[model samples]
Target chain A: MSEEKRIKVLLAKLGVEVHWRGVITVAGMLRDAGMEVVYIGNAFPPEIIETAIQEGVDVIGVSTLGGNHLTLGGELLELAKQKGVKDSMVFVIGGVFPPYDIPKLKDVGFDGIFGPGATQEEIVGFIKDAVSKKLGK
Target chain B: MSEEKTTKQILQEAEEKRKAERVPLYNPEALKQIKEKFDQWYNTKLREEDRKNWFVTPQTILGSEIPRGLLYTPLDVADLDYMQDIGFSGDEPYTRGIHPNMYRGRLFTVRQLAGFGGPEDTNERIKFLLAHGATGINIVFDLPTIQMYDSDDPMARGQVGWCGVAMDTVKDWEILFDGIPIDKISVSLVTHYPTNTAILFAMYLVMAERRGIPWDKLIGTVQNDIIMEEVVRSGAEYLPPKWVFKNQCDNIEFIRKNVPRWNFITYNGYNLREAGTSGVTEMAVAFTNAIDTLKELTGRGHDVDWICERLAFFWDPSMDFFEEVCRLRAARRLWYKIMKHQFNAKSPRSMWMRCHVQTSGISLTREEPLNNIVRAAYEALAAVLGGAQSMHVDSYDEAYSVPTEAAALVSVRTQQIIQAETGVTEVVDPLGGSFYVEWLTNEIEGRILDEIDEMQRLGGIVKVIETGWIHKKIADYAYKEQRKIEEGIIKIAGLNYFRAADVKLPEIDVFRYPEGVEERQRKKLQKIREERDNKEVQARLDELTRAARRGEPIIEYCIECARAMCTEGEMFKALKEAWGTWRPPAYW
Candidate 1:
């Protein structure tokens, strides 16, 4: 009956993404909700997954506003699967995403899709609920 | 002749008259009596419970949180002196407006920011807008070009032409302006940072030069700013702050002497304000940056008047209509003072606070996306009343994606309606004499000056960026504002409130970005690499390397490299090898 996990999460911007105010705001929001959030500046997709594995985080949030979601985002999830942590971790994507891209992102193995206007409370609640059920709390 | 006094006596009389014009607007005794009467009116007529401690503000940014008064009077602006503080528009210390007739003299230039996909695609859009009556041109490059990566580089994968135009070589510039008039209209290149400006702006120059346009007749602006890279723009490789500042001054030096009609730099306060800084902080940081830049140029033995006249500013006109109007008036006055007292600038043009403004994209909401149209209209109106030399109204769909042609046309219509039908611009600074506007103008001016003083005390803009002090300030501001929005302390119209509306986004189409842009750009770069004279490119790169190492100006070498069809990435690598690279400090 112990549901006291800190809900560790890792966040990073895709390469050369300049509109990172969204990532900073989300990282702060998660940290405010008592989540252990590790934020690394813009990195390559493989390096980001490697850091997530090394840090043993429960979620990977990749933010990119540069309209590269189809290719780069697909590669991000493919790397997660190749590294054998695809099922263990909940992958999420955020930032300037069109609503139509939601289905495609889900197809690429993104467990959650947060675009513009997604509230902080909604995100923190979603991640909390997903992580707790995974922990069997 | 006998009635005329001696020259000494005439000089003393003129000085005395000038001192007389500096008198205060209201006497202390009169103001005190009015204050007592206002309190009496308030206690009897106003309800006690109706008076709340909190205030609703037009903008939630810093310098905007305060108590509001139910009434404003002459007593509120008792300290204002009309002749000394604010005067007629187009006069010295041009607080009211830069031109005496304001819009009667000329309407504000409608510079819509349009770029996304490959160079030819954006070029077609530019021609369409021009045929449709847009007065000015504003070009924003894509993430790869803005970050100084070639279209073929792995770092540029999938992002070549997403955010803006993909420009790799001088050939791309040629394609971009293939049919456009170069000398007739003014172009604003959103080239942020020294290295990017050094590369892309050089391409623009080479393109125009190859077309045989005389350099002296060219008219446009390049955003050769350092703070935009160091503090505002996030997540990219940057040249070190010291070296970045040096290159910015070097651009000013070259442009002032060569392309004399073009504005070399528009110190970017717009990006700062949109990045969660207060309106006052935005002006303060921009003025401070200008002060430091002018100093660097003067140290190189250029007079203040020579290079400072073509310098310009870019500001963000936020939702606080009166506050922003006052900020602009106060900014004009303060800049005049700085140029006069600090730099002893001789030319009046050097003292003019010429600025191009844009509506705040952050202030637009994602919920009920159409609500953004009304919001942007109000912000555009504010920019007009504030006397922005040129302005771009953000489209409603900007909160979601790049604007469709329909959305962009609506933005142009927004500006058109304001300029033609509203009749708002018939008068210059019509709100100049309002008690609240005058009082707030003086108050915001003082606060901006105080911020400038604080920055100067703390080792100026470069040192503060190195230490990440400014970064922490902005982050804290953004975080607090977000918390307010989440707590419902600051309610967005359809988002945090009015939840009953059907917030369906299908009402408008999210712009379908042209497909295969990245592929086309990659192929173009590959062709240029194969076809262009590689030996000539290498010779120019070597000269860039040698010039960068000796700490000599590199813009000349960059121009030569552009002449040889050298790619932006090739020249940037040479400079990076010499001047070094920087990673921003992690303030969070």
Candidate 2:
């Protein structure tokens, strides 16, 4: 029997989102929940996805409160595909996104979308499920 | 009793009776009976149903979930002395208020924080606000300007005009206040330290001089409160803490001698509250910061009365109604005692706590953004009842973006409606004699006093900041508050609880600066550089560096540089050459 792999996630802030409180809180919570979480503070979308690919992270979680999530989120997915890591890596977003943008976010191939009131448990559970499903577990 | 009682005994009995009468209308025995009946009802009738249907969370004030009594009576506040603690308004230890007839005589100054994009954009907003009856102008600067960077710096990309107006040179200031008169309008530069403020102050002086306004006639406030910035916000230490202090003291001392009408430093606790501190922490930190600054100034042979009299405060009035009100009242009383007892200040003006309040931006919600208007209204009402000297209402769309002009106007109207239509301004300290408010005031006062004492014991505010003690406290509270919200312990309507399904998301018109604002700002700086006398600019910068190195007051030198048409970045570079910049200790 193969042993279960610990889910490796990379969390980053996209495009000048200087509100670090949410990103810091989510990083700490995910780390305590037994996941290998790498936080790349704040960077451009392409730079963030490059770090995800380099770190071999199974999930890329982008945190933003700057209202540029739609444009940046779409660019991140496109960059991941160009880098040939789309099937291997799952994309997730968490921050202050309006309810109207949820369907659009999912349509852009995000595995999960966490808004303002998402709990740590919900995030951990979703990340675990998404990673395992991607690995064909 | 039959024997003749002594004269002292009669006086003591009268004093006791007066103390007992200061509490609620009910006597102690009656209050006890009411509490007993409430307990019985809570246990037998309310407890079972509360458990079955509704989860009873603790009623908290600013994240301290201590249980409060259902009602308070004379018993709760019998120890308070009316003469010493709860004196009349405009009297010694002014707990009720600093003015005799606060709102009835004059309403608080309605100042909206208006700034975004270029100088022309902010200038238009200021004119609009003034036309709508705004009494003061609170100017917000862009991140680059606040960080002491030029607009053309590579580090300032994408952030030049997004947060606030991008100001790089004296020309920007001239355009910022184009048609507005400096003497009539009270302007506050909501900028930070350690050198940005000095540069901004120099620009203001240069502008006034160009317009033939005297130094003493210029009226405004520059938020040179670098202590709170070090403690809570971006831990960006432009220079070492001691250097920052020296620069701030230079401004205070220079302004005291030259510009008597301008407030040199406004100790801001609003950032602390926004960073998730309790009311007690906010009050304690602000007081400690002010006390430390006064001590430094006095040690330098400046009069304690002069510094204390000119000092002002900026606070955040959150959604907790009574607690917010009590926080301001207790702050006034505590500042009065601090000035009189600790500093031995004799001027009554020195003892009065003059404060400006901004409604809490942390309380605004991104879910139903319109609900923020209601939140701001209640907070503004609390600030009014708490006796603020000036107030700024946060725009409803602040959660999503920098407020559009429409949203900013609505925010100003929110305060206007409360000031004109609502009858809250008819009386001074309208909730003064309420039992719960009095008890809360006493409680908050005691807690803040204890924290201030602890800070003193921990080697004053500056030392605590250098050691990261207070920063740790803020971080711990912030994490706890976030956890409580995630756990559903703290219920925010439309966010955590009572969330609506199938809600139509409101289409907010987020303010977007015109493209190439940063490029235009850079071009303006270049034009000033090419048009001015380079030799004079270089000479002024060299003098500024020498004065900084020799520990001389550099405000005059800064004004010289401003007069020579030097850029902010050039002044900052000159100072950096004299005293190298500082890097804050790694926090987390």
**Per-residue alpha-carbon lDDT of candidate 1 for residues B502-532, written as tens digits (9 for 90 to 100):** 6666556888889899899889988888998
Provide the fnat value for model 2, as a fraction from 0 to 1: 0.05
> What is the lDDT for A109 in model 1?
89
Query: Which residue pairs come into collision in candidate 2?
Result: none
Residue B315 displacement in candidate 1 (angstroms) = 1.2
Clashing pairs in 1: none
Question: TM-score per candidate, in order?
Answer: 0.95, 0.85
> Model 2: per-residue lDDT, tens digit, A41-137?
6566678878987898888998876554676788788788898887898788987664556788888778888865567888888887887788564
Q: Among all windows of ten consecutive residues in candidate 1 chain B, which has the lowest summed lDDT?
A: B4-13
lDDT score, candidate 2, position A57: 89
**Judged by DockQ, which candidate is best?**
1
Taken over the whole model, the C-alpha lDDT of each candidate is 0.85, 0.78
Q: What is the C-alpha RMSD of each candidate to the true structure, in Å?
A: 5.6, 7.0
Off by over 4 Å in 1: A1-5, A134-137, B1-21, B27-33, B50-63
Which DockQ value does candidate 2 get? 0.20
